[model samples]
Target chain A: MTPALELSSIEGGYEPGLPILRGASLAVAPGEIVALLGPNGAGKSTLVKAAAGLVPIWSGQVFLNGRDITRTPAHRMVQEGLGFVPQTENIFANLSVLENLQLAAALVPKDRRGELSKMFALFPDLERLRKLPAGRLSGGQRQMLAVARALVASPSVLMLDEPSAGLSPKLIGVVFERLQAVREAGVTILLVEQNVKAALAIADRAAVLVEGRERLVGAAADLAQDPRLAGLYLGAGLEAA
Target chain B: MLQLLADGLVVGSVIALGAVGLTLTYSILRFANFGQGEFLTWGAYLAVTALGFVVAVTGGGVMQPIGPFSFGWELLVAMVIAAALTAGLALLVDWLLFQRLRARGAAITLVIASFGAALALRNLLQFLYGTLPEYYTREIQIAIRLVPRDVLGGLRITPDQLLVIGMTGAVVLGLHLLLTRTTLGRAMRATAMNPALARVAGVDVAAVIRATWIIGAALAAVAGVFAGLVGQIRPGLGFELLLPLFAAAILGGIGSVWGAVLGGFIVGLAESFSVPIFGAEYRAATAFLVLIAILLLRPNGLFGEKP
Candidate 1:
C-alpha cells in the first residue's frame, strides 16, 4: 500500500548551503502513527518541516499519497491535504477559539466547513472554551486547540512538531491518548517527539535520526526493546552495535 | 465653551477620517505610510476636476445651491467620483511602488519608499493644479445660530460644519459594522495580528492588502473634500495636515479604530482650547505636545494592547 507521506533521501535545512537533513528517508503508511525520535540538533524537526513544505528541501522529493508535492508553498500545503502544527505559536492567540476554527474552515470548500463540528466533537474541551481567546487557554488546552485546528482542515496527513513539549506529565498522557485516537480515525500522523517511551506506546512505528541521518527504522515494539537506542540517540558508538 | 466645542467637532471630523485610514494601514502594512496624506489631496483635486468637467458639459447651467450647502448636486456627484478615483490611485501607488518594497522585507526601505512616493504624488498634484488655494464653492453661507447671541455666548454652527460631523459619524458607524460584522473584516484583523497564521489558514493576504488601500484612500478622500469645503485646498493642503493626522493615529494607540476617532477628537479639542492660551499660531504645536505626553505616559496609546 502507498504511504500517506514519504520523504525520500531529502536534503534540506534553513540556509541554502547548510543542510540539516542529509539523505533522510522516512515513509508513513495510511492510518499509521510514526514517531520521529532524536536528540537536540538531530534534524528531526527539519525533516517534518520539509515534508510540510515549511523547510526548503534542496535535493529530494516529498510525496503525499503518491503525488510529488516537493515545490508546494507552505500556505498551499493545507489545501493539498497536509496539515502541520508547529511547536510554538501554533494557534492564533488573538482570535477566539471559535474564530480560530472558523478561520481554518474558511480555507476549505463551503460544503466542507461543517467539519468544525467534528473537530469540536473530537475536542469537547475546546467547545467549552469556544468563546475565549486561544491565548488565554492553558498550555495543554492550547495544544489541543492547535491540533483541532489542523484536524478541521481534514488533512490526510497531519505533521505535529513537539506537541508534548511544555506540557505537564498528566497533560502529556492526555495528548498521547488523543494522538492514538487521531491515528485510529484513519489520519496518518508524523509526530516529532522527545519522549521516546510515551511515543512508542502510541506510535505504530518509530525512526531515530542522528546528525541528519536516519540511524534506525523499525516497528515501535522492536525499537523499544533494542538496547542500542541509547547509544544511537546519545552518539555513543552505535556503529559498533 | 459651546462655540469652541462646535468648532472642535468640525476639525475633529476631518482628523478622524484621516486617522482611521492611517491607523488601519499602519497596523496591516506594518509601516507608516507618509503618502497617506496625499490621498486626501488627490481626492480633493479629483473632485474639483470632476466638478470642472460637469460645469463644462452643461455650460455651467442647472447649478443651484441645496439649502445651506454652498454648492449644488454637481459637487455631491463630484465627491463620489473623487473618492473612487482616489481609491484607484491608492491601489496604483501600492502596485507601482510599495508592493515591491514590501517583498524585500525591509521596514526602513518601505518607509523611505513611501516618503519618495509622497514627494512624487504631491509634486504631481502641484504640477496639475497650481500652488494657490482653491475652494469647492465661491459662495460663503452664513452660520446658523443654534443659540442666539444673548444665549450661550452666541453659539452657532455652519451647515458645512454640521455636514462634516454628520458624515464623520456615518463613516465611523459604517466602519464599526465592517470591522465587527463581516468575514473580510475578521480576516483583516487576523492578518494584522499574525499574517503567517492567517495566510496558512487560507486568507488571500494580497486581497486583504488591496482592500486596506481602498478603504484607507476612500475615507481620506472624504476628509479631503471636507477640508476643501471648510477651508481651502492647495498643493500643500494634505502636507500641513499630515503631522496632525499622525499625532491622532499615535494618540489612538496606533492600531485601534475607535482609538483613532477618540484621539482625533482629543487632538481637535486641544488645538481649539490652546488658542486662548498660546494664540492661533501655536495650534499645531498643541497637537504635538499632546502626542508627546501620551507617548511618555502610555506608550501604547489608550486602546493599544500591552505590546
Candidate 2:
C-alpha cells in the first residue's frame, strides 16, 4: 500500500551551501505513528521542517498521499493535507486558547469547522482554559494545544517536532497517550522526538537518523530491544556495531 | 486647564488613530514604517480630492452643513472613499516595495525602503496638490463654553472637536470588536505573535500581511481627514505628526492597540499642558521627554511583553 507521507532522498538547509538534511528519507503508512529518532544535530527536525516546507529544500521530493508537494509554501501545506508542529514557539502565545483553535479552524471550509468542537472534546483541559492566553498554559497543556491546533485542519498527515521536550515524565506519558488516541482517529503521524523510549512506546515504527540520513529503520518493538539503537545514538560507527 | 484637557483629547484622537496603524504595521511587518505618516498625508489629500469629486457630481447641495458640524454628508462619503483608496495605495506600495524587501528577510532593509517610500510619497503629494494648504470647509464656528471661568479654569469645546472625539471612540470600539471577535483579527494576532506557527496552523500569512496594510492604511486615512478637519491639509501634515505617532506606539507597547490609544492621550495631554511651561513651539519636544522618561522606567513599554 502507498504510504500516507513520503520523503525521498531529501537534501536541504537554511543556507544554500550548508545542508542540514542530506539525502534523508522516510515513509509513514496511513494511521501509523512513526517516530523519527536521532541525537543532537542529526537533522531530524530539519528533515521534518523541510517536508513541511518551512526549511528550503535544495533538491528533494515530498509526497502527501502520492501527490508531490515539495514546492508548496509552508502556509498552504495544511490545505494540501499536511500539518507540522515545531518544538518551540509552536503555539501563538499571545492568543487565547479558544482564539488559537478558532483561528486554525477558520482555515478549513465551513463544514469542516465542526472539528473544533471535536478538538475541545478530545482535550477537555483546553476547553476549561479556553479563555486563557496560551502563554499561561503549563508545559503539557501547551503541547496539547499545539497538537490540537494542527489537528484542527483535519490534515491526513501530522508532523510534530519534540512534543515531549520540556514536559515531565508523567506529562510525556499523558501526551504520548493522546498521540496514540490521535492515531486511532485515522491520522498518520511523523513525530520527531528526543525522548526515544516514550516515542517508541507509542510508535509502531521508528527511524533513527544519523548525519542527515536515516541509518536505521525497524519495528518499534524490535528497535527498542536492539543494542545498535544506543550505538547509533552514541555516534558509534555501523562497523563498530 | 479644562480647555487644555479638551484640546488634548481632540489632538489625541487623531494621534491614536494614526498610531494604531503604525503599531499594527510594526508588530506584523516587523519594521518601523516611516511611510506610515505618508498614509496619513495621502489619506487627507485623497479625501480632499474625493470630496471635490463628490461635490462636482452631487451638486453644491451635498456641501451644505449637516446640523452643528462644519462638513456635510459629502465629506463623510469622501472619507469612506479616501479610506478605500488609501488602503489600495498601501497595498500597492507593499506590492511594489515592501514585498520585495521582505523576500530578502531583513527588517532594516524594509525600514530603509519605507523611508525612501515616504520621501517619494510626500514629494509626489507636493507635486500633485501643490504647496498650498487645503480645507474641507471654509465655515467657522464659535467654541461653546461648557463651564464658567471660576469652575476649574473653565471648559470650552467646538462641535467639530466633539465630533472628532465621538467618532474616534466609535472607530476604536469597532476595532476592538474586530480584534476580539473576528477570525481575521485572531489570525492577525496569531501572525503577530508567532508567524511560523500561524502558517503551520493553515493561515495564509501573505493574506494576513495584505490585511494588515489595508486596515492600517484605512485608519491612517481617517486620521488624516480628521486632522484636516481640525487644522488644514498640507504635504507636511503626516510628517509633522509622525514623531508623536511613533512615541504613542512605543509607549503603548508597540503591538497593543488600547495601549497606543492611551499613550496618544498621555502624549497629547503632555503637549497641551506643556504649552504653559515650555510654550506652544516646544509641544513636540514635551512628547519626546515623556517618551524618554517612560522608556527609562519601563524599557519594554507599558503593554509590551517583557523580553
Candidate 3:
C-alpha cells in the first residue's frame, strides 16, 4: 500500500546546521499503527514536530497522501488530515470541554460535523464535562481530552507522543484500548511510545530508534523478539528487571 | 464636608465612565492601555469642536439652554459628538496599530506602542487647542435637596452634581446589563481568556476587537464631556484625568467590570478626603500613591485573581 505519511531524508530542529533529527525518515501506511519505540531523548519528539510542520525541515521533504506539504502551518496541516496530540499543554485550560472539541472542529468542514457526536461518544466523561472547564479534569481525563481533540478533525494520520505518560495502570489500559479502537476505525497512527510491549502488541510494524538514529526497522513481533534489540536496549533494561 | 461629598460624587461619576472604557479594553484586549486617558482628553476637545458646528448651524451661541431644567443642552450635544468622534478614533487606532501588533505576535510591543500613539495624539491636541482652559457658560443649577442644613454639621448640594451622579448611575447600570445578558459579551469574554482558542471555536476576533475599541472610547468620551461641563475644560482635560481613571481600573481589577466600578468611587472619595489632608496640589498624586499601595497590598487590584 502507498504510504499515507512519507518522510525521506528528513532533518530538522530549532536552529540551522545543528539538527536534532539527524537525517531521520519513516512512513505510515493507511489503516496501520506504526510504533516508534525509542529511549528518552532519541529525537522522537523532534521527528513528530517536524512532521506536524511545527519545526522546519532543514534538508528533506515531507509528503501527505502523495502531496507535498513541506511548508504548511501546523493549523493548516490539521485540516489536511494530519493530527498531532502533543505531550502536554495541548488544550486551553480555561476553555470548556465542549469548546475544546469545537476548536478542533474549526479546522474541519461544516458538512463533516456529524462526526462531532461520534467524537463525544468515544469519550463519555468529556461529554459529561462538556460545559465544565478543562482545568477541572484529572490527568487521565485530560489526556483523553487531548486525544479526542485531534481525532475530531477526522485526520488520515494521527501522531501521539507518549499517550500513557503520567497515567495510572487502569487508565493506561483504557487509553491503549481506545487507541486500538481508533486503529480499527482505519486512521493511520504513528505513535512514539516508551511502553515497548504494549505498543508492539498493537503495532503492525515498528522502528527502533537509539540516540537520534533509526537502529532497526521491522515487523512488530519480529523486532520485539530480535536478538540485537534484546541485547542492546530492551534486553539491557530487562536484565535488571 | 457635605460639599466635598457632592463634588466627589460628580467627579466620581466621570471616573466611573472613564474606568468603564479602560476596563472593557483591558478585559477584551488583555492589555493595560496607558493611553486611554488621553483619548478622554481628545474626546472633550472634539466635543468643543462639535459644539462649534452646532452653534454655527443654529446660531444658538455654542452653549444651548436646556429648557427650564437650569442646565445646558450644549453639553448634551458635545457629549454625543465626543462619543462618536472618539469611537471613530479608537477604531482607527486598532486598525492601524493594535490589530497589526496582535497579528504579528507583538503583545508587549503593542502596549508600548499604545503609549507612543497616546503621546502623538496628546501632542497633536495640544498643538491644535493651546493651553487655555474653557468651560460651558454657567447656568443657574437648582439643587436637589437630600438633607436639610445643620443636620450633623452641614449638608449642601447642586443640580449639576445631582445630574452628574444621575447620568453616571444610568450608564453603569446599562453597561452591567449589557455584559451580563448578551451573546456578544459572552463571546468577548471567551476571546479574552484565550485568543487562539477563540479563533478555533470560530469566533470572529476582529469584530470583537472593533466593538471593544468603540465601547472603550465611547466611555472615555462620556467621562471627558461631563468633566468639561463640571470643571474647566482644557486641551489636557483627558490627560489630567488619566492617572485617577487608570487607578480606578487597576483597583477594580484588570479585567473585572464590577471591580472597576467599585474602584471608581473608592478613588473619588480618596481624592476628596486627601485634598483636606494633603492640599489641592497633591490631588493628582493620590493616583500614584494608590498604585504603590495596590502593589504592596493587592497587586492584582481588588478585583484581580490570585497570581
Better of 1 and 2 by DockQ: 2
DockQ of each: 0.48, 0.85, 0.14
Q: Compare candidates 1 and 3 on DockQ and give the better one.
A: 1
Off by over 4 Å in 1: A236-241, B54-67, B73-76, B148-154
State candidate 1's TM-score.
0.92
Error of 1 at B25 (Å): 2.1
Which has the greatest TM-score?
2
Q: What stretches of model 2 exceed 4 Å from their correct place? A: B60-62
TM-score of 2: 0.97
Q: Local error of candidate 1 at B199, Å?
A: 2.1
- For model 2, the DockQ equals 0.85
Q: Please report, as a residue range, the 10-residue window in candidate 2 chain B with the lowest summed lDDT.
A: B59-68
In candidate 2, position B272 carries an lDDT of 89
Give the alpha carbon lDDT tens digit for every residue of B7-65 in model 1.
Answer: 88888888889999999999899999998899999999899998888766764544577
Q: What is the TM-score of chain B alone in each candidate?
A: 0.96, 0.98, 0.92
Grade the docking of candidate 2.
high
Please give the ranking of all candidate structures by lDDT, highest first, separated by commas.
Answer: 2, 1, 3
In the range B1-307, model 3's lDDT, one tens digit per residue, is 7766776777788887888888889878877787898888888888888877776677657455665444467567767888989999999888888888875655678789888988988888889988788655567666655677676445566666677789888888888776644646655666777664444333466787888888889988888877877777787777777888888888888787778878887788778878989999998888789877987899898978775
